[model samples]
Target: MDDTSRIGAAPRRAGDDVIQVHARLRSMILDCTLEPGSKVTQAELSRLTDAGRTPLREALRMLQQEGLVKAELNKRITIAAFDLDKLDCTYAYRISIEAAAIRVTASLLSTAEFDELDRTLVDMGEAIERRDRDEFEGPHRRFHQMLVSHVQEGARARMAIDADWAERVRRFVMQGDQHSLARADAEHREILEACRARDGVRASRLLASHLARSAFYVAAQLEPTYDTILTRTALRMVLGDELAQTAK
Candidate 1:
């Protein structure tokens, strides 16, 4: 099926329609189809998503809360512009929260949770082998989510949103040599091993370093001189000064 047709296909229920529309719109923004910093009216979005005003408005409102779009004065909405500073801070927030959460969560993972994580790793490996980022994304998110499953509800919700935002920044800012898929998989394995050993400190340090390096790599691509100081600071806070310095 064509992209527009697929995105615009109506759902059976009104609530489903809103969710479908939201996912479609979010995908478009993240895929850069609705290019960053571009401005469009409600009418344009309605036609683009082939969604009615009610569902489209609801979807836009959701995206607005996620900081993916900005509602303007004349019913226009601007796609959130890509910013290096924002990207840095996003990773910083993620590093701090996930590292802290994993410290408590790692020792608590059950056999079923470990099995689920193992399956996700296998799925991620298959996706990587196929060079299918869309496929890889699901398992990747699941891997992270499962690690922090025991975290408090509010922080867990924030992590979910941050995951989407992190994916958006990676799509928008990272390219070419900035990517290290192989190393990423390796890091995932190491982190998993640490969790398996019930070594929360090791897992937390590994996760912080993994997240920090990703942010620093992306920042380097955008501006070689750009320092993701916030990310570094977060890593240090999680891993401490000596370990953080050697985390790279």
Candidate 2:
């Protein structure tokens, strides 16, 4: 019996291995450590993840379900390729869903939640000073997660995946200058203020605008001709034409 078969002898331990490998693979893909649109063999993955055949196959299935990888005829897996159109679609979905969710979530935040958000903002500022993208991302993601913590699990899960994609694109493309970082920090504070005031409508508009701006900027960097129609439409839906016009 192989090492995988040995591990499979214990059902519970094997199950845990599957979950860990799944998470590891997912993170590697999202972080671009595996590279988008690259063809990878199962042997390569097993070596990279330290996962045996059984667990690696199980984990690949999970990633396939998430649409992160495609199984091929010859057995190599294709990582999902990055595209400008998909980026717009992803941001559009985030703008629509997160805007609506935050409208409800804004008024529901407790004082403790507000305090936590403040700390995240502080952490983000420190990360900016250090010029560390990885450091900034943790608190930055947590800050957004907290905004919709009261929502249904399914919606939150979808939003989390989209958020990961958005962050990945940002890291892959735009190299931030100090000016842009300061602007983003200010935007986060503004959104937090709206939520703190319990103004769901304003908070929703701010969140939508924030997401739209990021989408537009990233799209422009990659392909200036590619109009982000879906993202623009979603922003207009959340913020009316007049405000949406001003948002860009």
Candidate 3:
């Protein structure tokens, strides 16, 4: 669906066989290269990625734990569906963690690093102007990575993966509206401005509101049958208790 497979480029070192294999397979699953609800064979993944059996097995096991790949009692392996709570939970924690990351990152960026962020923003704006999803995805992904890079490595890794997952789900729901790109441009500019001013509290609050806005928008569009936290309690937790009260 519009080359979304690359939307979430989870970072990994090239030399680590298991991590590389896992990242490749996970990207496939998230991008729908390995379509949701489809059965996947061990040999098939091995051949597709050219990874050895041991690494492939290890990668699959890890994916299973992440709830992206499911193993059945009958030795079946299936790619998880888009219609899962994994996306919900991903955003729930992502909102909180990423806000914290931005707070730390904004406070810590070097002037040179801040310039790098500006470059990505420029690239993203140009992509949106052209309405080119392919062009946008790279800088967009990089923009997010750049945002959280100043945090601890562990937190950076989680934010990268979770952000990718959240982006995928957002694409599923939003269908790549160009209008949203406009909103994103405006919001991202404000986020960077907060960073420029070195206001961690303002940056963190903006980041939280940015995520909460998306969650609320998606919730409104989902049909009644979907099992999401459009319900008050779950929504508040993700949206932040204070923001939730303010919305009312």
Q: What is the C-alpha lDDT of each candidate?
A: 0.85, 0.85, 0.72
The residue pairs that clash in candidate 3, if any, are none
| 1 or 3, greater by TM-score | 1
lDDT of candidate 2 over 40-113, digit per residue (tens):
99988888887878998999999899778999988899998868888889999999999999999999999999
TM-score of 3: 0.64
Worst window of 10 by summed lDDT in candidate 3: 169-178
Residue-by-residue lDDT tens digits, candidate 3, 46-165: 778878777888888998887788887765689977654555566667667877788788888898988988999999999888876557778877877877778788988878777766
Better of 1 and 3 by lDDT: 1
Top candidate on TM-score is 1
lDDT of 2: 0.85
Q: Which of 1 and 2 is the better model by TM-score? A: 1
How much does candidate 1 score in TM-score?
Answer: 0.79
Pairs that clash in candidate 1: none
